[model samples]
Target: MPSRRAVLAGISTGALTSLTGCVSTKRTGATPGTDSNTDWPMFGADRMRSGYAPSAAAPRSSPTERFTASLEGTPIGQPIIADGTVLQSTWYGIEAFDAVSGELLWRFRDEEPGDTAVQYQPPAVHDGVAYVGTESGLVALDVESGDEQWRIETASRVSAPPVAGYDWHHLYIGTIEGELLEVSLEDRASSSPGTVRWKRSVYGEIVRLVAPNIAGVTAGTTGGEVYMVYDGRGLWRTKVPGGVTAMTAEQGNSLYVATFGGGVLKLRTAAHAGRVSWHTEVGPVAQGLLVRAAGAVYGADGGGLTKLGTDGGRERWTFAEAASTIPAAAGDTLYIGGTDSILAYKLSGGTGVAGARIDPQRWQYTHDGGYASGVSIADGAVFAAVGDEPRLLAVE
Candidate 1:
């Protein structure tokens, strides 16, 4: 890909004012979602922040032939697994459900009935602290204790979960106004909010205003700028191009970035964006959702699971098992959620999909939704959320 853009042109102070000014109105639209079980709290399940859920969930049937409910909405966000329960968020507040039984556990509707709304992304939980994001900002609730912690307006909209780790746990996110922020989650977690850790622009010069998707923050900036500041150690502000959305596929020091229009770009995360490792065309995938395992890279691009050969982004296999859901993995199996069905697959080879096992009917038959932004494996079953409805789903 081309090198990062030259120094960012002058950004008028007015733009910042308008962006900050608009933040107040962001809250007027958030849905009030809450959780019942605190075990598998937060977006990634634990504070170490890995998007994997753990629970001894039994699939309805071996090689399940069909899905079960009419839950409604798509799987645009990842689901959290906890105490045999699943938690998810959508345009509504947080919704909790029984993972194995597929039962609604609790719903937190913080929004007023007449309020206009935008989709609020999933939140993260640690030590019982639940963190949910909205168009207005980030809100904190105690999962086990059942209490509100602190609510901070961080953006016109937050499309990703607040990532936590290190002594100074931080909330990483993007805004509709086109900016990136890293706030200290340590504050809310500890009941003491701190100053904004660091803020960066993603437009003009090295930054390209990027509004992340529900998958979370996976960005690669320009001018050799490459950042993935989950914790303080991985914190970097280098330069690369190909604006980053929530979707990211990384292995070792390499970060595979996808864009909304341009396509997937490979960035070397040497903490120095001065070099371009390689470039390949994966189309302008709306989400560059991917994970690496056993020397292979799997992602949800276009509308399926793509198994690629790492060296140059060559396709080894493609499975349209579920459309658009960020593919998740457990052991040797991969889970996919689609508009109407949720599917699972075990790699058969390096040339095309080997085989697929799908739930013939919609797992939650209520609505034809499955943005499957993220997935997790715990105990044995898989946990994910459906889109729109923000219903938590657990399909064994």
Candidate 2:
């Protein structure tokens, strides 16, 4: 047995409504301590909604060099890496820079329009297309050309980043008011019913990319409802039980739900017609969720951390505020940004991943006054957004 030591490693809202739009993207790198270019896709990469990024970046014990910082506003949205370019959405707009050099690449900007309030989710980009979710509306732009691709809007605001499915045929986004609008990517790019894939309602507003379906795109509602439309032909709705803020992981087999109120549920998508298989209560006030390679489900809350078995319902382990930030897993290692330090854990069952001196030189980063946003792991580096500065830290 392990003593919570042994292996060492590292690292919502609606404003009232506008506050929820500025989501923080936290994930672990896949390949141990190397921040690779590929791997992380969508909020949690997998359908189960686990908030883990499997990159090959080395776990940076400390940041190589801190950057120019985002004075625009705090970076609540996660940073995305595509084709060697890193794109992050701040309260201001979408800013792209070189992943390795930190060179300013390009920026798509916007103003709050009025005291209306602002919420922005990290943009999703691929090939050369970048899709952004802003306080006012959504915009489609060419990643390389920097030319406008298409545009869509809603009376309300958009803070959750856009998730793409249907091979760019359709774009799904959630709003600060809880509206799930479907837009088209056709030559015209209109969200008309013909082009509209589908839409749903969440008694609460949609926060981030913790989407409903596994294709890792079509999002569910904030009211704990999973919206599904078979092949975009018919509509089906199912309610989980609580409001969702973060997506855990999107595995190939099941859909995992991490609720803001509490608990992490594993639902198996039917071989033919999928429905809820079973659900087990893990804990309360679960603000975060994660799944290990061992298939063990984990989550974080105000009290501490808790673990659940993959079998649907079972309690595993819980770590205190000392280990609160959403946990990220890649291979057998787990990384966490805790109240005291950036901790690492080994999932071999012995003790668990913890007990390392990240920034042992000085415990400058604290989770009380501010949150340690989610982690983005690659090769051997960790990217984190912290404080009011909207700073993206690189630890390797």
Candidate 3:
């Protein structure tokens, strides 16, 4: 395989543009039908942020690269797959591409020539609209044509990804200034976007926001506090030992939170009260998303990737790779993106004992850009953004 830089250097500007144009015609400008069971939508599969694809069957062996497409700007979040299209949020704008052929479909830019609107998080797509957050505000665009449907300005920078309610009738977003805004979907139907259904202020900068299994929103703050809100009122607040780094993942009635202070906490998200069931110190939690699978909760940080038993929060297994991105799982196979390569691991044995370990024989994909933004899997294919220049890599 050629180095990423070599492959990129070999392609001329005209040739790349021509290839992009060829793939553009393959798109029909219609919203592609979606298979909810196989699609990896939202930040971590769903509002719970589980980062687990239950219906996906990831390749058992290391897969070969299918294609790579360059983007306009840096991608700081995971790419979302739906309706045969892959949606990516970059610093400059939001882009859509044909999922199988690596063709550019459409691009949406909300900033002016000299204006700056940094979009570092993934966009949540539901029905036919893609909701994305920018430094200035949130914007909704048509998934098929990349046309702006509505734009709503925020009081401050919108840094995290927006999540849709379970009913798909509401959108939840948090800002850097600690304001959580709930936007009405019915208002968007009436051509009124940004209608504030309700807004609540939390204690510190809100970095990770998720909608739990219960009726309200859960937000983790930079001040190490997790706040649960219903309507416009605070329901419960729990302080972790350290600053919260990522969104919480839910299983049954439990919420799993990763903290920078080197621990993962299991809490109950019922009755407007969050009660910690167990707190297991696992290295420093990564500043990305946390994943739950089988009977374990997986987290990564500067220390490495650690798996803790979901029952009593016991350490199951730890891999010594410095990871800052969330891990994705399909079946018993877990895929993690590290600083330079994508690794494949097998979750062996039953519920207890050491479950996950790196498959030393499995083929690993190496790139010059490094796998910084994480990985996502759908329909037997693995998707990732590699290197600092960031090209979307598809493997199967």
Candidate 4:
């Protein structure tokens, strides 16, 4: 596999600047979550939430445990990788570690040492900055030193990760009270701290947000409404059966959504008022998001992991005993977190055999507490945060 730097070198600077608003010339202070090709900057790896890492290859055999670092609190969401560092979000604060050695590098607390300021969403790292959402509001920290760059307090708790626009000049964050705020990242250097570009009201509490492309932002709400806003205008709103748990985009034209009750819906972004191409009842979806890769849509629910055909929503395979967290892909292997182990499965033509058991030949890592957080692959290693225990482990 090619290195991240090598993969990034092939991306035209003009294309990079046009897509993200910042030229990929400077690697030192580039936006925290902007290097999707190499780093798992945010959930689903990129703005489209594909959850697929192209440069990193999945481990063919069982990996050897490298190291595990204890955390201050339980990890609430997935950990992101950037510049050889792993960033994790916990109930207490944000923790960073050396990706290769699992050494504690820096810790950023949103509140005082003793006071508890719960942070449920993972931080989005880009351009040397780590943007995290806490109970108070959105806080930006310098990734290198863990210093506070700026913070914006919101009216309610922020449980969802902040999505960076293509230009990295703006950040769109959703609050627990159903409000979406657009923050200006460019004005942080001035005395103003940061500016609120605009604020919009959605139907319910926004649980997930993603910028599929430069055209607009797709937001999923707890009220079962998915809103697409572009250029500060609400383009369309599509209502699903249950509260939206996760969402992803395909080629900027299709939106894949996973609901809490037990369903996955695919909507056309450019259709007349957003048309539902297909909807399939998977099972009771717990907390994992939907991922699109290898020409199929993969989702995890209370029933386990299910692979659905993207063309017609046909059920291809179902793993009813896997982890409830979202699975990550590298090459043809699918890594999933279970209640007590990290297991790998083979994906043949984007589908697994129904009622098929996990092959012992593949990689498997068992721990005291089950793996709950999403797996991040980089530098030929798999990084995961162990649930219940305050630990993050790297296997290679």
Candidate 5:
């Protein structure tokens, strides 16, 4: 395939603004339909931040490049596949593309001409609106046309991706100032788009958040403090051993938290209190979103992916040389994005001996670019954003 580097020129600020400023840039005008079971709509595939996509028929053998598109900024968050479109969040804004053809559909950048604030969080698509975090606020854009529907400024910078329940009625997020925001999505269809339902003080730098259901939201702070807020009230609060780096929910009541202190803790989200289920040491410093799939929890830290059993948090096997991005698992295969390649590995089903090292390489798709992070799979297709040069690659 020929390089698409020549198409790197960004749309002029004025032109881009017009596209997002209530003007249609190829609006389908069709009401966004419900996403399929295989759609990787948001970060970690769902509001729980679980990076598993069990229904997606991911590639089993060596994957082939379908298409590639150059981007305008360094990609930060993971690629989101929803409603036949792939959305990637970069340092500047979000870029949407045709999931199959890799065509640039529409780009949304809310930054002013000289603003230096960066948008590091990924976007979440619910119903038909895409919720993206800007430097100081959250903006909702029409998924069909890139039209700006509404925006609400936060108390501080959004620290993680905005998440929503299945109904999309309430949006939840954390902030650098230790605030957990619950934004109402009920008014999104009205003339005025959004409303800040409430902002509760978490008392520490809130870094990660997960909304397992509409009534409850779990937030993790930089100080290792975790809180379970239900129905706009703090239901429970607890602390792990280290700074919380990421979190994932299993079966709605169980949460797996990866910490920077070299451990992954399983916590029970009960109505009365947050109880530690199990704490398993992974690497020297465990980080990244915990992935729950095939009856195991996967944590990444220090260039390795560790698989642990869900029953007792026992270490199963470690896949060394894992990349920076979270791995996507479906069925028996794990797809990882490396610096310049996307690799597939055959999962051992956690039946192997504990702490065993394994690397059953299945396939690899290479690109002559920078970091190939944000590996997302949906409907048998894999998508990744190559950072530095900023390019999106589609494979199947």
Candidate 6:
């Protein structure tokens, strides 16, 4: 097989066409639940929700489609990689597929004989299990068998993506009613698998939650509140200019926030106090997304995408295209899911073009339907789920 660079070089001269048939490969006995160091196992790529895949070997030039598979339902969020399987949560259920050949592995649904469970957030995989937030509460399913291991019901609906840490056997989840609940997954091997460790009310709808490798949790609320909590106690709370739509943390100390009111703010939270380190109005919108990678922070919304320096929040570059979801980064290329396609941009600018509105457009993959979720990179494949016409495409 040709190297990824060689493959790109072979097709760099022109736009690639949409793949006609799905690709299939023989199974290699790789278990979907087995954790791999390079896997994009959750949203934002880690417990910190930084959306950076440092170890992944991504494309250096234009990429071509590796496979495409139709999904059972519309995907709710970005698809994640678990071991060698691609997992996507949809309105009807969750579907798992072979990442290499786009083969169907298994399906897990909350529907029972007479009742159906509704979920709105993506799942986080840890220790051979997938944890998801549903309207009722938290649900844990075995990654290999798609079996329900256990569940814990909460007072409100969990509407935000979950974060799982390897350091502890606990899963952190956010609800629509401003509750941050930590559920212990230590008893996952038993018949009764989960227990709510603690819950804290941030007094507003919890929009996002990050469980850093450190000893605390950081939450962003839709009511413009950012809270730092440790051991179920509020350590510090501060207000931002607008409702927090997205947040990314750098090593658990520097928290970068994107707001609906149109700005990005960096907060210093190392000493259990929330202090604004720097703030800038660089085009972040009401439904913004942030990714901390390549020594810079990328913020995107419906309007466009902006790149800012991490040291002092300096504006680096701006792409005047609507970004519908969080961007992903690997190596020197940044991938953004746009209104009608997945666009790639170079992190470094050309000489004599410092802070130029121009970004070297690296590659573009256009789909008939718009993107339903953000782009995810794993195992040399870029996975994107499409909207209206539900399907998942793997580009290499």
Distance (Å) between predicted and true CA of 65, model 6?
A: 1.6
lDDT of 3 by residue, 171-248 (tens): 899999999988876655553555777889998878888886446788998889999888878889998888888765
Residue 108, candidate 1: Cα error in Å is 2.5
lDDT of 5 by residue, 1-396 (tens): 422122222335564455454432222122212223478878888888878766567777777888999987888757988887888988767889888898899988887757784765788897778888877788888888889988888768888788885577778878888888888888555323477777788868777888886577889888888998876689889988888888888675888888886488888887537798888865324355777776677766665667777778887666655676766766567777765788777665222224322235677777877666668878577788888678998887
For residues 74-152, what per-residue lDDT tens digits would candidate 2 score against the true structure? 5654466666666666655676766676677776666743443355676666556777776667777777545677666
As a TM-score, model 6 comes out at 0.84
What TM-score do all the candidates reach, one by one?
0.67, 0.73, 0.84, 0.84, 0.85, 0.84
Model 4 segments more than 4 A misplaced: 1-37, 187-193, 283-286, 349-361
Worst 10 residues of 5 by lDDT: 24-33
lDDT of 1: 0.49
Q: Of 2 and 5, which scores higher on lDDT?
A: 5
Per-structure clash totals for the candidates:
51, 70, 1, 11, 0, 1
Tens-place lDDT per residue, model 4, 179-285, is: 78877777555424367766788888899898877756889988999998876689898999999888878785888888887488888886656788888876336
Each prediction's RMSD over C-alphas, in Å, is 15.9, 10.3, 12.4, 12.0, 14.4, 10.0
Worst 10 residues of 4 by lDDT: 24-33
Off by over 4 Å in 5: 1-37, 187-193, 283-286, 349-352, 355-359
- Give the total clashing residue pairs for model 5: 0
TM-score winner, 2 or 5: 5
Question: Tens digits of per-residue lDDT for model 1 on 13-105?
Answer: 564354453322211121211222324454434432322222223242244312233343444466665555456665556766656666665
